[model samples]
Target: MAATKGSLSINSENIFPIIKKWLYSDHDIFFRELISNGCDAITKLKKLSLIGEYEFKDDEESELKVQVIANAKDKTLTFIDNGIGMTAEEIDEYINQIAFSGAEAFLEQYKDKTNEDQIIGHFGLGFYSAFMVADRVTIESLSYKEGSKAVKWECENGLEFSMDDCDKTDRGTKITLYLNDDSLEFANEFKAREIIHKYCSFMPVEIFLSNPNAEPEYDTIPESEVTDKDTVIETIVEEAKTEEKENEDGTKEVVEVSPATTKAKILKRPKSISNPVPLWTKHPNECTEEEYRQFYHEVFMDYKEPLFWIHLNMDYPFNLKGILYFPKINTEFESVEGVIKLYNNQVFIADNIKEVIPEFLMVLKGVIDCPDLPLNVSRSALQNDGFVKKISDYITKKVADKLSGMCKTDKENYEKYWDDISPFIKYGCLKDEKFCEKMSDYVLFKNIDDKFLTFKECLEKNKEAHENTIFYTTDPVQQSQYINMYRNENIDVVILKDAIDQPFITQLEQKNENVKFVRIDAELTNTFKEEVNEDELKEMTDKLTEAFKKALNRDTLDVKVEKMKDSSISSMITLSEESRRMQDMMKMYGMAGMDPSMFGGAGETLVLNSNNNLVKYIIDNPEGENTDLICKQLYDLAMISHTPLNPESMTAFIERSNKILEIITK
Candidate 1:
């Protein structure tokens, strides 16, 4: 065919900017798009061969491969694949025509009964993504059809491209990119290798990376597979894989034979930079536990083995396979991105996509390969797609099921790992209502005694004693007095220390009626003493309330006289749960011109233990200096229990304490 020049179909105006900037979210996606195209070409050819539409030579290798070579010095990169290549007319139909996918056409025609593989590219624009990081790109292809002319197509960063015949004799396509100065990093061997390992690590087809600076690598295959004369055979011992047999006699004999050695043939193989058989791609039963752990270590580069893993192999709803690992997360709220590598038929898409991964599952680290996800002309189209939502729900359900199973079968281990994974569970519950519903049963709370109990267990155990209220403490030290008071009464309080805990407790309250989470230091309810008369109780309460109000100059103080369960504690000051949370929010946001002292006055309630002797003395002696001095000191003590006093209050308390000490000494 004669050389011809023409403008690309889509843009009357130059659309290179659109392809470069808007085609993919990341500039590096160009690598995924181009590599996926190569993989697609290989898959299409294999499909044709399987269906008898194309014939394979008896001597030809059965497998197809993709090869990538990057030259940092030349600032050039080449992608080559031995698959179903395109003729001149095919190139014009696929390459020159913007967004017209030949792979889609072939899938439409031949995808009815395809199996064991997937065709990756649906949008022809994937090939044009090369322009994202390239000043110019050239494609040379030889079609699989007999006697077809090898064609070469060249395009700069412009609307027009030239297509002509080339002298390529092999049946494959080679795409070379002349990278621009700003995009020259793509031509670096290390950078290209990183991108390939990120995007194409688990691609079904083998991918080989080559660079001039690196030493050549030779691949050694099994001896049984070698048939070529040029192959150099070697022996590799397989330790721990001995063949054991019983002697002719009844007795067994120990024979120390060298470990089984595999007969191997060596070929100067291109540097294969992909794990063609990813753990997730294999059947779950076939994958060993150690293999799953090793795969996680290799993918994440974490030294610690994952605590456990869930292998998801679903074929029915929409081809989804994944391995989600639960890593030992010693840290939380630390901007750590849980890497759930998303893949479309082993080609890397993105990690932890909100549309595909539930927000709660984002803390998990693993890989999910789903080819059913729809892709259009651009990468941005991936977000908010219906298929993505379904996949996200499926993953969330899988995680919930795994957690529920663990809690049921391995209660001890579940309790052991509860502390580490609880934050993730709580966060998930707060973010996703569906996940919360599924995971509510497995949610566990850690008590002050370091015991783990489920929400229902805690509620059931303390429902009668605490009136269905769950007591919790944010800081054990700052609220030690309150904790001690509760411990004296043999009451257990759960620890809510995480940033997510407040919201999680709020969610539990909203979802579960008749359940309440009250901070240990906040809002102690009133209970009348069975021995004391109602008139005496009311009289002591009014006297103590008037004394504290006059002494602290906060007339709004709602004081209560409660016969204490313990004889030691004389008084306790508490605040409403809502008021305390509001104060926390104000402190967090640093709201100017607002004082916590304003809330301090109205939010506080003083609970006086009437059982203590000091409280009896204050109730009996009303207007004397002894009563006035003790009342001020008791009010300050209760204030200090709720929050540490400021410098002025501290100084006043110290001065008043010294005067009392001087009087006692004299």
Candidate 2:
């Protein structure tokens, strides 16, 4: 190889500026890109060794790794890897070209002989990400070819780069970045180490950090100080009780005292930031509960333990390995983007990427490493290609399978976590039809009676009476009267309190034919039985409607009288299910810039109980403030029970109550 100079193959002269300012969202990602490229080169060497195409020296036979060297004085950061180095021709083809992929080109050249997925990097833009932090980058590499000379390549954030033979005779690649003034932080040993630990915590290769003139701190003490066997003592205390009763958490502690438990173990802390063998790389049977929890906290930085996790491992359809955790919902992170760290192999790419992760699943915190992820040059977003769709579908299916499996094997445990996980399930059903179909059976509801039942159980339990209808309540407090009324009739009402549930019900009904979910307060279900005939009810309704009109002065008010079994209640506000949905939609989007209270405009239905003694009394004395007071109170009671009262209505109710109190006292 001889000295040569050439301009990079790029269309725009401002490519480096675009890469620095807009290519990657975070500036710290330059280290990840550069280091991952080094890892890719190492993997290529391993693959070639396994295929018997290349022989490795005795030193190359050991474990392969990536090392980071940061020199603050020189303001330079370097990445070194024990992997396949590039020849002069290879550098001209791969480095000079901007978007061309060297690994992909190699795979095509050795299509019949090599495994295509062994390579970790696909985009050539990784090397240029260095320009985001540095003004100039240099590469010194010696190819594994029999009589190869060391080659050096240098470019100062521009298309013109020089490649020449160097004095270096190493068999691997070394990438050195001369830090720019703005990115001098990367040259700091502490900053570079922190960035490496954050992004390369679980990379497949062993990554060691080194700083010049650094003092070595030793945690490996003398063998005499270390104990070969350590005993842990345990104590137990029993609380005596008269009878075994379940706690609110659904667990009961029995009063029984046994021997103290003891265990032996060696105590040692982790030495490296990266786990060479990650949880996802191992089989589910081999994984322990403690290991899963450890990984969860380490990756998400979530302090609380996860409710459960799904281990995804598939090699055939596409190599996908991951651990998706169902974090306790309603945490401080409910509004934050979840920590679903996406990866290519073990190298992290991004978090909460919609193309790789289903939008609903993005609510979860986990890691998904798939070499098959079709990433673009920047490696920030997924490419609009077909294989990425398969990866997304596979993840959705795996999650549905996990939820369904847990329900079948452990009903008690499934219900224990239903409240926290229901929102995720409902959102998944609303967003994905395939997920809806898979999760429809496992979709659960907690009735007001504190019973957990799936969709089928709910339907079967209420089928004879409610008939293909599932009555639910969005606000337990506001709908308590209706809930109590339903309970008196031995009717069960499911609680749908999550904000997403309003739209989720529509999807559920569309998926399950002939099944409908109506809000308990929105309509009167068949649980209420009316005895009075239509003619008798209409005549009484006509009299009561006329007397109440003047008291409740709204001219367009629609009030229907019904003869109910419960005569204690005079009136209950009823809105059609259709109207309630319309109101919710309008309120969510806008009510024509008007106050949301106008949603009760023409859709408000006040169903008065004709069987109530108060209605009969009002109709008989239908002429004075005595009748007006009772009518107003009845209407106000219904208004408060149905929804929160507007300020105007609340003030009026207070004044009327005071007037009634004064009159009674006089």
Each model's number of backbone clashes? 0, 0
**What is the C-alpha lDDT profile of model 2 across 83-110, one tens digit per residue?**
8888888988888877667888878877
Clash pairs for candidate 1: none
Q: RMSD to native for every prediction?
A: 6.6, 10.4
Cα lDDT listed for each candidate: 0.81, 0.81
Lowest lDDT sum, 10 consecutive residues, model 2, at 228-237
Kindly report which residue stretches of model 2 are placed more than 4 angstroms away from their true locations once superposed.
Answer: 1-27, 48-63, 86-114, 142-151, 159-171, 213-220, 223-271, 331-333, 511-514, 523-530, 533-539, 592-602, 658-666
Which portions of model 1 show Cα errors greater than 4 Å? 10-18, 53-63, 112-116, 213-269, 383-385, 523-561, 581-601, 610-641, 644-666
- Give lDDT: candidate 1, residue 73: 77
Supply the global lDDT for candidate 1: 0.81
